[model samples]
Target: MSKPKVIVIGAGIMGLATAWQLAKKGANVTVLEQSAVPNPVGSSVDDHRLIRYPYGDKPGFVAMVRQAFGAWDEMWADLGERHYHESGTLVFGGPNTPRAKVQADVLATQGIDVEWLSPAQLVRDYPLLMLDDLDGGFRLPTGGTLRCGRIVAALYRHLTFQGMDIRPFTQVKDVDPVTASVTLADGSKLTADKIVIAAGAWLTKLLPDMASRVTPSRQIVIYVRPPAGTADAWRKMPCLLDIDGGNNGFYLVPPTPGTGLKIGDHIFSRQGDPSAERIVAKAEAQAILDKCAGRFRNHGDYRIIEGKACFYTVEPDEKLLIEARDKALILSPCSGHGFKFGSIVGTRAADVVMGAADAEQVRRWATGEAP
Candidate 1:
């Protein structure tokens, strides 16, 4: 029996992951990437992307996170190398803050052990952090960092070894969902038994009809080196969500072994051309630091390693939009919070592609609604 043929556009994490799952299912898979596979500017290709369980009001993610861990573990087994580092995770808040505590209680109800901390406790535990006017925090062992660059690179190698055709620098100019075909920029068209559009920020560019629904979000992330006095403290730092309830509330990934300290906010920029220059403006980088000022000790001495611009698709509701249009499935598992679910989201996408799962159910599940 001939294997079902599948073509996936966009070699970002979501695209690559869906391809990975389809290939493993005995499907003939070809991945077309406008840039190189694991595109550096791709949202998933970075020193580290976080995997945490504290979804303040989004309880559906909490359950998905549990499954995400298992999916990633299965990938690790297949790759023969673990590209994850589970240092820990912390969610902290300001004076009279109840959201951080609410996050803790939510996790506790899921039977996950959560360590609640008081303002005084935070100061004693994480001394390098500025603790003034802080009230609540929590520590959890399940969430940490996923070494994204390494994982994607490994996936590329594994997929290549499996004889999957991955074409880089092959831009898709038009996608005809009804025919399950893609017209390339060079005026060539390729038809497939099934097509998956896991395109990231470029989703709107290919499927212009989705322009009003999902948008490309330009986000900024910075890597910094802490001063000598606080280097030790940073070495022990956990992935943190600085929950001050403002636009500056960024999630931070610690400078664990072989990684640099990364800080970025969850707030979406809501605008930016993915095809345009991704140069990070000095003011944009500085603005992030300004929002974080006084939150870190020796803030002025922290050296900026790199300030980069990245992009992702975001819906107003910030849920994963995985839907189908005839033989083509549009999987935009985006927003600012999509990286953590990369592994399992791919598995679910495969289920839909192979006709094993209902597309509407997967759509509802991805949106955090009842599946």
Candidate 2:
């Protein structure tokens, strides 16, 4: 596999990151993107994506996150710019605390400290919160936001500088796994030593066999401007997550230096066409504001700056779905939590393609079962 020629589909974070890693490993990689490198409809093209230590019942991801951070650090070094902001995380253990407690225990094993916030403290400190909960929560210094859009752009530039071929607006119609070739919408074909289908939400279109295994999800996130009364709190607010058992609660990313205040729920719509126009309905915007307004002060007057819709590939069990398909590999580090692991997903997969890593090991690791 020395200097293998590879063809990568999709130019989102995962796709571009894979190309970057592949180029680093001396592979001649050609990346075909349906849209621009920083595709606006991409799940990774957001103002910010969150990374927190508390993974609820999925403790394996807690350790995997450590590797993700390391990978990000390496990318930052290569780009000479750090696109992450450590705002910490404020957790609210709603009526359900079992999953929250498991998260706490997992963090404890890693020597991460959690400062418990009593009910009285919640009332005194975060005046922005409604604090209807009967009990208390904690604040861990291990969560933050990654500048997603910036990272994508930087990776694209980095790959280009490395002499990698990245073609945007090149739609891939189908793939020939046996010969490791990709058929374009224009009837042009390109062959390579290996093929990568990291097409995020549109993965099923390229690999119909994965339709039952991965469902495209339509998720919305709204950027808002807080009233002057709570502007300070909103500006200083750490990335917050409320542990509400199975029913997904809201996760808020506070404003960073050049970012907006973002709020999105963890629930998956499980219904969307990635090729369809992204229209964020008024009801959709209201739904998010309504669910999160109760958690903040000066909510009624807060103005919705913008509402954007992104699509994600979700699996039934909520773990990453990275599998091998003859000469092609399908990478889905998503289920609403993919962007955070973009760098590592590319690194591990590229290593496998370069014959530097074990394929089954990467799959197992992505499933959160790697030791």
Candidate 3:
């Protein structure tokens, strides 16, 4: 029997990871990316992304995150490159806040080497944070940050080294489920035994009927320089999420090797077209800076060093939609928090395409199969 030919759409973390897995399994694979390889606008272009084991109330996601770390480490070792930072992570919030307690409880239940820090303890241990208003928080020693852009580039490079065909600047205009073929924007058609749609925010655009299933929302991320002398302090700081701060859902990542500290709010509730989304405007960027100024210590000058607008292809339940749509397996992992699980999602997406796993199994291992 001939080996199956798999074509994966989108070249972001999810698509590249899936293609890498499929190619390694002796399948003929081709990755179609609409823009240039590692496009700057996609969710994967960020310098750093948080990688934590305990995901609040999502046990399955917690498991998937754990597995993803292993995969990332293996890849880094193979490439002889540092791709992840073991800077730890702090999830702090109010006493009765559900997210904080859930994270604490989850860490305790999993025996994940998490420390429950009281308000005073947090202030003493991590003086950079605003602990006066916070009730308590949990610290996971194993959590860290992942070099997102580098990972995506490395995956693409590795797959290219393995002789997989990667077509950049090739937009997948349409897909014919019956024929298992994809038509590119230039009117060229390519056939594959299986297809995987890991298109991120563009997934719904490709399948309009499923638009309601996935909505693309614009989000802002900002990078700012810490107070001059405090650069070193911020460098040593762990990734932090203020899960209960003003219901704004703020998170901060340490300086990305060369870039300044990164901060963003996860409070977007509006949808927009991914292709036409606006980069962070001055007013919005200033607001984010102001928010960070109050929450973090020594966050000075507040210059909008850099700002970006990315799309989050959110599901109603905020869970991933990993299922088979005809001959193609749709692998949209835009649950607003998908970047953290990129490696694991990529591997599972490949498994789904190869018939090695089903959506239920993947969901069971990733998010507990939704009750």
RMSD (Cα, Å) of candidate 2?
1.7
All models: lDDT?
A: 0.85, 0.85, 0.77
- Candidate 2 vs candidate 3: which has greater lDDT? 2
Candidate 1 to native Cα RMSD, angstroms: 1.6
lDDT of 2: 0.85
Per-candidate alpha-carbon RMSD to the true structure: 1.6, 1.7, 2.1
Q: Which 10 residues in a row give candidate 1 its minimum summed lDDT?
A: 93-102
Q: TM-scores, in order shown?
A: 0.96, 0.96, 0.93
Residue range 68-175, candidate 3, lDDT tens digits: 777776667756676887887777764476877776677666567667778888788877666787777777677777788888888778778877899899999998
Model 2 steric clash pairs: none
Clashes of each: 0, 0, 1
Candidate 2 lDDT over 1-371, as tens digits, reads 46799999999888888888888888899999999889988888878899888777665788888889999999999998899999888777622466556667778887776887778886787887788663777787777999999999998888888778899999999998889998899999999999988999999998898898999998888998888767667777788875464555887889888898888977889997989998898889878887875677667877888998889999998889778888988898899988888988999989888889888988999988884
The TM-score obtained by model 1 is 0.96
Looking at candidate 3, what is the lDDT of residue 52? Answer: 75
Quote the positional error of residue 240 for candidate 2 in Å: 1.3
